[model samples]
Target: MHETVTVAHDDAAVVKMADLFDPEPATWGLRGDPYVWAALRKHLSGKDIPASLNEVLALLHAAFDELVGLDLVTEPASSVYREQYAHGGMSGGMIDLDAWRQRLIPLLTERARMRLEA
Candidate 1:
């Protein structure tokens, strides 16, 4: 069976997304994943969500750049992870984790931000 989850479009919901970084064990899974943790910290700041989609996209872009700048997701590391996955190891489903951080996430987050804006 497939389960459906829905989030209401409101500041409270946006704030909940931002609160994923709250350092509790329940939310700490992403904390050990360097790329995701850093990107989240860079993008979601303060207690309130911004008022515009452009601002949200800008934050996401900034977060992506910050993750790259930090070297948390390095090409060499990504290559290693890719090789492991190819050899049947579970490298979190991505052939390249860095590529996911640098490319896909910003694209997806921007799309979500646009939907939230609407």
Candidate 2:
């Protein structure tokens, strides 16, 4: 059986999408993943929801590239080095690009499209 879902088109929906950043998603690939989440949250804060999925995706990709300092969507790298997040010794400031593209981004997009009202 397939569940029906509605995509909310309001500021509250935008807020919900932005909230997806906090509480630190469990599916992070590296130590610096939380840093990226924070950055994404900041990027999406007070932002309007795009009219089209493609537009929203483009906005998300731009934010991701800006935070990670590389165009993961276009370049598709294994990882990217970040000096700001380098404080963590284990990850060595590297954010797993594939994880963001394959996992986190999709999760965020899914949430972005979810209905706020029952």
Q: Which prediction has the highest lDDT against the true structure? A: 2
- Candidate 1 residue lDDT tens string, 1-118: 9999996777645553354344422222221244454446645666354566566555555664454443433334552232212323244413344545565455445555654666
Enumerate clash totals for all models, in the order shown.
Answer: 0, 0
Model 2 accuracy (lDDT, Cα): 0.73
Query: Can you give the lDDT of residue 80 in candidate 2?
Result: 77
TM-score for candidate 1, residues paired by index: 0.36
lDDT of 2 by residue, 27-74 (tens): 678777778888788878877666556766788899887777778757
Any runs in candidate 2 off by more than 4 Å, and if so which? 1-17, 116-118
Among these predictions, the greatest TM-score belongs to 2
Error of 2 at 28 (Å): 0.9
Model 1 is weakest, by summed lDDT over 10 consecutive residues, at 24-33
What is every candidate's alpha-carbon RMSD to the true fold?
13.4, 9.7
Candidate 1 residue 107 C-alpha distance from true site, Å: 7.2
* lDDT values, one for every candidate: 0.46, 0.73
